[model samples]
Target: MLLERILRFFIVLIMAIVGGTLFELAVPTANAYFTAPLWHEEIAVLGLSPAGLLCILCGTALGGMIGYPLAPFVTGWLRRLSLWVEAQLGKMPTRDVIAGAMGLFIGLIIARLLGDAFFTIPIVGDYIPIVFSIVLGYLGVHIMVRKQQELAEVFDFIPRFFRDMPRVREARVAPQAPAAVRDGQTDRQYKLLDTSVIIDGRIADICETGFLEGTLLIPVFVLEELQHIADSADSLKRVRGRRGLDILQKIRKESRMKVEITEADFEEIAEVDSKLLQLAQEVGGKIITNDFNLNKVAQLRGVSVLNINALSNAVKPVAIPGDLMTVQIVRPGKEHGQGLAYLDDGTMIVVDGGYRCMNEVVSVEVTSALQTAAGRMIFAKLTR
Candidate 1:
């Protein structure tokens, strides 16, 4: 194929030369231009005999012969210059045809205006045209090379170009997330479960509702923490640890949401909550849990957090203070006069003056509702 292309190129070159020569012979202006010998009258060293004209024509043909070997080198150089500029400048073509044309024009003007004066000079006069051509062409090539770096000036142009183009209006659309990322726009969130909530077993309900859309990454450190609790001599700790493992399994098996058990433990930070924050940033994912301290830490670190307790509180029936409700007084509060009850969603109902109703259901009138990151706490009074 390459040989055929070379043959075709030579065929075209020969045809052009022959056609141009014939055209010049047929046209009066062209015939005068070609018949007028270049550098023939200027050279007086060769005698003005018929032999001198023959000698001048022979010299010109010899120069052409010398340049024949250089044709491939020149062709390859031009091709590389064009291809390299295309690679560098991308969409905006970097070819400086204006500069090159200017260069050739400058060369011709200098050669014509100073041709006689330069010829009057000694030995260097003979080389003046060649030297001028080289200098002008080099200047043009230098300008073109420098223009290649003009992209540095337009570094800001990149983002603006993308913005101005109509085709990329949805540039911000999140790349198709994995199929498991179907947490319902819940901020690609993860909800960390505290030992208590995992034991409470309501996290599985939240996952089942598909309210959470991000990869459920259970930090390996958290599992170790759970393991530490489970190994404790205390029965409650062991039960909670086993419950967390069970919840983890349910999340894995029943849900399309990705459940990743990442072994990211920060031993240097003694608190597991600190480790969770670090891992959240590493994964670029939100933290999910019921621990209030963990929630705060994640927030301060700029990591998103989903609190199961917060979700539970949000979904709870809004009971404004001054509303009366019936609840069983489950336990005594911190103060001697205080008794505590719980709503079905686990919101604490602190009942004042209801110690007598301990272990029994009674009517309590709501007072002030205290809301915190932990959850909503309802303060009430025994009116029964």
Candidate 2:
């Protein structure tokens, strides 16, 4: 609102200036066309010559009056148009936008050199340069944006060059103590928590165990997402969202690990997962998540990710083939005559031929164990 008012004030000032200039021009034109016929003799008006002070006073007053009423609407329209353009630009990925700008600059440089060669042609020569510049600039931006990833690879040499540069020798000075040593060992790796890991609620327990180190960085946008979910009309979603918030509070109050909520945001990225990935890259930190798809995406983007599910799978008690264990068949599995049970660590155990023993404890012989993206599944047969 303050910005809008400031813009309106400037718009009014500019309009008043323009209106004054127009009126000043109109007075002289009117005198040349109509003043001689309308007045028999030159008369002093407003205590000065009619064409002098009177004209100036009337033009200035009329201009200010006309400009005062129109500024608000014009400034409001301009503000809205600027906001719309900014939103459109924000939707584009940062890398693509940078690549396109670089390409456009290079294209214009080439076009200017080519245009100079065509300067001697004729009337067509005058327009050919402009047409070439427009066409080449468009093509350059389009192609560069499309191939932005490959261009990134090509530019890897820039960093390599700086790394290879020789350093100048100087008198040695004592190194200052590291920030971690001075801060009571509180400085640790920043582990950015994702919404999935938060909702899973195991992170709070892990933090309590002191197995996890470093400050847990929670972005404000992630909290907003949890709030959105907590307010959802769906009961399951609301429960999960509230559970995530509860886990966050528990970690902050009870856990030994340092927890920090960050307000950093990427206005350009709409997806929370993408924003998280970008944040991880910016902070040179690891992403903590249980989302399989997000894990894959982060890995593809060369960002470090610590998947809670993977960690759980790695630490769960190993169930080898032919091992005998007792489990209660709580439900039937997708396959016929197969019953499903869960181990203490939540590993799925498919008990063969135990469907008839539902809700009953039975000794089962493990047949095989399969590790998948979701988690580990153990297949077993009911012991005879």
Instruction: Specify the highest-lDDT model's number.
Output: 2
What local lDDT score does residue 51 receive in model 2, on the 0 to 100 scale?
Answer: 63
lDDT of 1 by residue, 1-384 (tens): 585457445644554455445444444331122233556434333434334445444554554554456556655776789889767656432244444455557656766666656777788888886776677657655664455335433775788586536534332353222212322333545544445556567778777777777667676667777788878899987888887888777666555576655445566888777776675665567666677777677777898777767777788888787898989988899888899898877889989887878899998888898888667888999885
The residue ranges of model 1 lying beyond 4 angstroms of the native Cα positions read 1-200, 232-235, 263-272, 330-340, 350-360, 372-374, 381-384
Highest TM-score model number = 2
Q: Each model's C-alpha lDDT?
A: 0.65, 0.80
For model 2, how does the per-residue alpha-carbon lDDT over 112-214 read when each residue is reduced to its tens digit?
8999999789888898889889998998899888776567557876885665343212111211222232233433688999998999999988988989888
Scanning candidate 1 in windows of ten residues, the lowest lDDT window is 175-184
**Residue 245 accuracy (lDDT) in model 2:** 96
Name the TM-score of candidate 1: 0.43
Using all chains and alpha carbons, the TM-scores for the candidates as numbered come to 0.43, 0.50
* Model 2 residue 357 distance off true place after TM-score fit, in angstroms: 2.8
